[model samples]
Target: MVSVDYLTKPLDIFKEMCRILKPGGLAIMSFSNRCFWTKAISIWTSTGDADHVLIVGSYFHYAGGFEPPEAVDISPNPGLTDPMYIVYSRKLATA
Candidate 1:
């Protein structure tokens, strides 16, 4: 997941990911600080990097059938260039 802009309905995508994943499998979604502004959703384009993590986490929570999502900042240089981050969730064993 380089840019979330391509997703018209993110929740649906999350649900689909969960549906296809094996028990305890991880669904890791990553994104950068930059994206095609014209193609991104207003929330994605307007919010800061930290908020983007929250937004992605919400998708997992709302989609259900998964454990709590975890956020990670994997940026090599915080301010040198576009920062990179990831939000991952695991499908429940019983899901």
Candidate 2:
């Protein structure tokens, strides 16, 4: 099984995943919500944990090579101020 860290650009990782996945097979990935207070604190504090990888909205938009992802709020009462977001996406056909 191939696993990559979230610090890697989402697009590059997605591209590689597309290459490895069997046709019609599904790949699952998780991204960090930049607005999450915990992430902010970690960054400000610089805890230096290897898990501290920042994935913001723009990363998906530009560096990550993804468009608007199909999203569902697992959390109750999702508002603009909410700090965490969970997104799920699937790879389309490869050219």
Best by TM-score: 1
Query: Mind giving the per-residue lDDT tens digits that candidate 2 earns over 1-95?
Result: 11223233546756665566665445544333343344344432343222322333233334332344444344345554433334444444442
Candidate 1 lDDT for residue 64: 96
Q: Please give the lDDT score at residue 68 for candidate 2.
A: 40
Error of 1 at 16 (Å): 0.7
lDDT of 1 by residue, 1-95 (tens): 78665688988989999999999999999998778788889988888988999999999999999999999999988888779999999999999
Looking at model 2, residue 6 earns an lDDT score of 24
Error of 1 at 55 (Å): 0.4
Reference-based lDDT, each prediction: 0.90, 0.40
- What lDDT does candidate 1 reach at residue 41? 92
TM-score of 2: 0.40
